[model samples]
Target: MAYKPPTRAGATVYVWSNYSLQERDRRWKAVRESGAKAGFDCIFVPLGDGIDARYLTQLRCSSVVLPTDGRPPIIIADRSSSNTWAPEPWQTSREWSEPMAEALLELGMERARIGVAGLKGGRVSHVTSIDGVVNHGAFAAVMRRLPNARFEEATDILGFARYIKSAEEIASMRKAVEIAEAGLAELAAAARSGVDAAALYARVMARMLELGAEYFPWALTLGMSDGSDAKRFTDPPLGRRLKANSLAQTEMIAVFGTQIAEEDQAVLLGPIPEAWKPVVARQREIFDEGVKLLTPGRSCAELLEFSKSVAEKGGMKAKVRLVGRGAGDDGPVIGAMTQPDALKELTVEKNTLWLWRPTVTGADGKTRFTWGGTVLVTEKDGELLSKRAHGAISVA
Candidate 1:
C-alpha cells in the first residue's frame, strides 16, 4: 500500500506501553506535548498497573485510556497495553493485536477503507514476542473481521511529527549531553595511561551518574592504530588498558528519564595520532556542510546529498547516511538519518531541532572521525544547541 499521512491530524492519539509506568508516562507526555504543538487536539494515555494517575493528570490533553467497548473509531489494544488488559487473550504480541483488529471491525473501519492509525515494526521478522509482528497481524485480524476497515501504520505519522524537536525534548537531550560530556571530560582528566578500557568505562558511568544521568552512555571504542580493527566499534570491552598513545573513539548514549541521548568524541591520550590532524579537519568540514544544509526548506535527502559531496571532496568513501536524527521518545526513528525508503520525507521545518553527526574516514585509511552538534531550526537558519569550540575536536 502507498504510504498515507494520518487522517486523525487533530484526533486524539493513544500511547500504550509495558515499561516502567513512570518512564512510559514520561514518553507519552513528551508525545502529548509534541502533538499539541503540532495542532493535535488530544493525546490520550491509558492508566495501567503501577501508573501514577496523579502525575499524568497535569497534562491538558485527555490522558486516560478507557475500557474497550465494541465501537468503531475507538482504537483498542495499543502495542504495549493489550496484554496488560487481557493477559490470557494476549499470549504473545500477535494475540494482543487481535483485540485492536476486533475493535476496528466493530468501529466500521475495514480493509483499505482508511481512517485508522496504528504502529508497526520496521520488519515483520524483527517483531518480538511482546509486540506481535508490527501492525500486520492486528491490521489483518481487524480486516478479517470487517472487510471495509482501512488502517495505516501510526509509526510513520507519529515519527514524522516527532522529527522536529521541541523545547522540552531539547532540554531533555541537553541534560543527557551535558551529563555525558562532563563524564567524558572528567574521564579524560582521571584517565591514566594504563587504565583498562572497562575501568575507564566504569569511571565514565560513575561520573555520569554523579552528574544525574539515568544510565551510562555505553563504552568508548579503543581504535586500533592500524584501522583494520574498526569493526571493534560494536565489540564489548576487552578490559584492555589504555595505552599511553593509543587512539580512542568515544560515543555515548545517555538516558534522561526515559529518553535516549547520544554524543561522540575522539581523543589521543598521550601523543596525537599522525593521521588524526587531517581526519579531524575533514570531520569538521563535514560538520560545516551538514550544518549549512540544515536550513529551512531543505529535505533530509537533499542535506544527505550535500554531505556526500563534502565526503567525496574530503576523499572519504564511508557510507555516512545521516549525521543525526530526532532524539526524543525513541532513540533512532525520532533522531537522525531518515532512510530513502523511510515512510516520511524529512522536510526541515521551522522550530525543528536536530542533532547531526556527519562522520568520514580520513585520507589515511587508518584514521576515522565523526563530529556535529544539536541545532534548532529557525525561520532563517539552524540554531546551535550544543556549544562547541572550533572544529569537531573540542580539545581541552
Candidate 2:
C-alpha cells in the first residue's frame, strides 16, 4: 500500500542519520499541520551505530511513514550502490542527484523552494564524513538539475527542533545513562597497576554490551598520567601497562537505542599524590557548581560565566572545553567562548539534554582538572543523568 501524504504545500527537507526518524516525522507533521507539504530527502542509509538498517528497509518499502500521522512521507533515498545499504529488488535506485530531481518533479515541485541539510562552510549535522559528502553532493545535484528551484539551508531549523526531547526519547536516554554508569563502574574496577589501556577498554566495553547497551557511536578515550605533569598523554590502547602511582583518566559514551550518555573520570591506581589530592578535590567542586547552574531557561553564556567563577574559587583558570550540546541525533554543539552570543540567546528548554564539561588549567598551564556529565533540563533544575559520583575514584 502506498502511504498518502497529508494535505499541505509540499516542501523537500533533507536529513541524514544524526537526525532520527522520530525527529523527521515530527518535522513533517509540524509542516503538514502548518499547511505546508513536508517530505524527507535522506542523503544515504547510515550503516553503523545510532541508526538501524531495518528502519531504512521500512522507509524504502513504504511500510512506515511519519510515526505520528501515519502519512506516507515522500522519501528520496540515495540509490548509488556505494551510498545505499544492502540493496533490495523493490528499492528505487538512482544516482545521487537524479532521484532528488525526479522526486521534486513527481511532486510537481520543479520550481518550488527546497530545504537542504547544510550550507556552504556551515556546521554539519551528520555523525560521519561520508554522510556530510553525500549531503553536499545532493545539494549540488539539486542545483544543477533544477536551476529554477529555490534552495534554503535548514540546519538550525532542524537543530533547535531536536533540543526538546519527546517522552520516548527521554526513556531511551535514561537507559543510556544506566549503561554509562555500569560501564564506568567496570572502568574503575579495571583501572589498576599492570593493567594496559587496551585491556581496560575491552573489559569496560564488553561489560557495557553485556549489560544491554545497543552500541557506542564513539570510542572511549583512556589515558595515563603520573601527576608530575598536568598533561595526559593518550593514544589507542596499545598494551602500555599502568604504574602503581599512575592516574587513569577516561572519557566514554554509551548508546541505548540511539540515545547517548557520557562518563569522564580519573581513577587513582595507587596512593594519591599529595599535590594531586587538592586538584581532584577542586575538580569535584567545579563539577558540582557547574551542574547546579543547569536549570531550565538558563543560557550557555550564563553557564560559561559560572564556570569562570567556579574555577577562580577553586584556585585555577577556567578553560572551557565544551559548554553543552544537543545529546541525541541532532548534535547542535554550543561552545563557551567561540559562539558566545549565539549561546547567550539560546536558552535551555525543559526536556532538552546536554553534555557540559568545565575544565580548569593549573598555574603551570601543563596540569589540568576537568569534570562533567550528561544533564537533562527540567522544570526546576538540571538533572544529572549518570548515577556515578562526580569526583575521581580511588581504584587501588
Tens digits of per-residue lDDT for model 2 on 1-396?
222222332232322233355654564455333223343332222112112222333232121112223334345332321112322211233233554455455555456655443242123134222233224554466578678766654333334444567776677778777887787788777777777767777788888888777555335434444435223333346756666756666666777645677767666676655556566667666667666777887766676566555546545566544434333344335444455544546666788787777666655554556666788878888888878766667777
TM-score of each: 0.64, 0.74
Q: Which 10 consecutive positions of candidate 1 have the poorest summed lDDT?
A: 46-55
lDDT for each candidate structure: 0.47, 0.53
TM-score of 1: 0.64
Model 1 lDDT per residue over 104-174, tens place: 33333343333222233321111112242233543455446556433333333344444545556556666
RMSD, one per candidate, in order: 9.9, 7.6
Worst 10 residues of 2 by lDDT: 60-69
The number of the candidate with the highest lDDT is 2
Clashes of each: 18, 2
